[model samples]
Target: MPSETKNDRIFPVSPEKNDTQNIELDLLLQAVFLKYGYDFRNYSKAHLKRRINQRLNISNLETISELQNKILWDKEFFRLFLKDLSINVTEMFRDPDFYAAFREKVVSVLKTYAHIKVWHAGCATGEEVYSLAIILKEENLLARTQIYATDINKSVLETAKQGIYSKKEMELYERNYKEAGGKGELSNYYTSKYGSVLFDKSLSKNIVFADHNLVTDGVFAEVHLIFCRNVLIYFDKLLQNKVLGLFSDSLAKRGFLCLGTKESLKFTDYENKFQAVDKKMRIYKKLYIPK
Candidate 1:
């Protein structure tokens, strides 16, 4: 053997270094899990890579190792990365057609339930929470309902609790509301101040905004309906199945599960466990008895 160096890539370090990078990624996931308990280990490799690249760019890191080093040293960086990883990318009534179908099909059945518990999982900035609130209010069920709005991003959670959005965004949201079959004036929900829309404080009376990570946390409450839209796409197949498992367990008997327009349980192992209540709306009702 002759003198070798780390940069040699063959003499001291193996020329085939893919295994080393994989081991590094494994260790990084283990470290993050053990430290913050926000599990991203099973998330989709493509999405994770995208998010990781975004984080690295924002942090000005030269390599994944550099990002990992910063994450280990700066807890704040970890939180920021989590925000980049989990925050929903859009506005209220994200898909108006979905809401319209939901109102027509699901709300009718929802009215039959004496009381309701709705969970808006990965509810970034609370727009969907308010949307659901409006629907429930119109249906005369808001007074007897409990809404749990959860997300992994603490910063977004705070914003969701505040329920303040820019006037411009509110304008678009109002349009979305109207198109989604809103029963009353969208202006009734919020007041304008400083060029922004501040939603009525009363709307959130029955709502709870809390930090909940689908990746690692267990179900906090059993719910009559779970609206976990656009969140599972961030997760890999294994993680998607795990999160769906938690949802299946969390939903009450004969409950509803709503996913994003692009997502479905068809390929998931849970397909047979849920029946399509609104095919186009991506809404499914859980089976009362598993076949």
Candidate 2:
């Protein structure tokens, strides 16, 4: 006997059911883009599915259609949904080896520049932003550097601008700082209050926190260095290429670009545009071919 069930009832699943769900998901993404300005159309479908399913479970919604209806009708609910889609998993001095390589290989080249402009794309909550600031300060380059740290989520940007983090995170951050070849104590960079730590205001003096979407936004600035680690993995191949093109256009000739350990420029349209500086750290320098 063929039966259809709802609300946790055991029923025979059909291929048609999966097709319908995919269509519903597509419609929901389209609705989000039309209603809000955010574009998630080209995002990785697998990543989208996991995040959407998690939101559904959290909101106790039965279907993607139902979720879409709430998102469209309730502005506050959409804000919550946007947070779910945003990737905010970041820590100070993440991948210590990458920072070590940056200090060893990239910092020396940056010294030659009179003024440095850095773009930290997808800089969620600004932990790594401050980490870079601390490095620059130690290397005597902070005074001449201006870092633009941008993210799509305004809520996270607000948190980033405040530069406050839970004190509980300091132990791990301190350990990461030491491993990243810190010249002095990590504790010198922040002050503790109640249960949170506020990073030194000087660390953020040259940083500008702004809302920028990598999916739909164009070239932000002609930067000397770009740190967009662990961000491209969430995008599909097409979006990855599009964003890489934007980065390639945004970077100055002979500028440096740093990606996550798992991310790379291989098989992309911009592969030949960059030469690897530290392949293991996913660092690359733009080629200086004459135009």
Candidate 3:
């Protein structure tokens, strides 16, 4: 009595599908959030795709779905995947102009504070962390200041704590230190051993390296200065605004916030809350906007 449909049609029907890799990728991110509690949902989609594809290639998996399955089931694979996604790209005295500007403009203000707190958010591998320490040491503020360096990736945090780096890297680091207005040779802080350099243990005497995800974590300290450079470019606008708000809450009155040369407070909702200390170098001072 009922008319035969595709079941009785001449050609056999293939399974119905709308399987785009992007869809699978979104699902993968959602699964990761639910299963692991690491929020990568709002990261730049293009960046996520590229990094995920790289993982796919390395794992010999054919699709994002396959990679997602492995990531959910295998803890080790998830660690490697997190490392790939969090991509720690950093160097000591990166963009020497920023450090030089900080020394000139920010150090004088910091000297006024008897006890100072500094937060280095998204400190990858601690290159810049030690760079700041060197500056504070030269300025005689290291003894009075507490430096808190945080990164989302635990592996990088561990590496940052060790404070070891390749000798080859020191060549560029030394040049940068001098350009950033170092008074003495950068080598004075570290000893060479087996083609590597071990930085002075005393440099980290006041530094606290910890795992803190700006995405998932709340404000951890009220500080005199915050250095978060080259870390926001990877986040989307929403994430950027969210993290910027966190920074606003964490900074003390008239505290300074330093970003990468390419990053700025312009176009952000809190742009009005900060006045540029060095607009060209991307340093800003929090304003006392009456609530």
Candidate 4:
């Protein structure tokens, strides 16, 4: 319960009290699922508890039950609580090496296709989507590619649609772009004004930003590539396997699937369904048949 500690302990208490707290957390997640239809029941318990505890500290609540009461009645507070639960951390060309590998390994396959459809799952704030757009543009593939950028949070989807980011963050993103094998000036894609940068609307001409929840929603689109980086780390094994199955069902044969460096399909039920394209980069190709 101490601050600045990397403690796996959710909260310390007597065994009896700990059991009650666990039940409280489960009931709260169930309520959220039933009322809002945004399922978080299968999410990693430690992660959820950490986030909920942070809210409890801010709201001066002593228990998870207290937080649940406010969530059921106070719509505004529920919105803030929901936002806390949805992990939206992301950056453009997040892992430069992954993008670099994509440039080297995936682009060639894409070139073979007259048209391409890419699904960017859990595309928080659209940074990576724009990064891919710039890559495709330089490769002369943007005109033929349709990018489907989706996230469970509608607010983040709007942010992605606008393609605006803080001017201050451009320095880091520019560095990432270069490391990711950017072929042209990064500034050419966006104009800066009044402390913000608004990316060219044309970058999104072939892109679609929509609200899609991997937890409860069904397969959305058949795509050639699926980029879901830095997302599965927050999910439990069960949820991870479930989402992987969804990706398998949606991807075209021999299509590519990219995940965060920390995520892999090694022990999942769908492992045989994908062939590792770059194990270090966590990129995989959907096999035509399990091998």
Candidate with maximal lDDT: 2
Model 4 root mean square deviation, Cα atoms:
2.8
Task: Give the alpha-carbon lDDT of every model.
Answer: 0.84, 0.92, 0.91, 0.90
Order of the predicted models by TM-score, top scorer first: 2, 4, 3, 1
Model 1's alpha-carbon lDDT is: 0.84
What lDDT is reached at residue 95 by model 1?
Answer: 96
TM-scores, all candidates, are: 0.90, 0.95, 0.93, 0.94
Task: Give Cα distance to truth, residue 107, candidate 3, Å.
Answer: 0.3
lDDT of 3 at 22: 71
Superior by lDDT: candidate 3 or candidate 4: 3
Q: Which model is ahead, 2 or 3, in terms of TM-score?
A: 2
lDDT of 4 by residue, 1-291 (tens): 557553323454467866888899999999998888889999998889789877877777878999999999898898899889887888888999999999999999999999999999999899999999999999999999999999998888999999999999999999999999998878999999999999999899999999899999998789999999888888888999999999999999899999998888986888888899999999999989755
Candidate 2 TM-score versus the reference: 0.95
Which prediction has more favorable TM-score, 2 or 4? 2
lDDT of 2 by residue, 137-218 (tens): 9999999999999999999999999999999999999999999999999999999999999999999999999999998889
Candidate with the larger lDDT of 2 and 3: 2
- Report the Cα lDDT for candidate 4: 0.90
lDDT of 1 by residue, 28-147 (tens): 777888887878888776666566666655566645777778778899888777776775686888899999999998998888988899999999988888988888888888998999
Clashing pairs in 2: none
- Total clashing pairs for each candidate: 1, 0, 0, 0
lDDT, model 1, position 81: 73
Q: Which sections of candidate 4 miss by over 4 Å?
A: 1-16
| Model 3 stretches astray by more than 4 angstroms | 1-19
RMSD of each: 6.4, 3.7, 8.8, 2.8
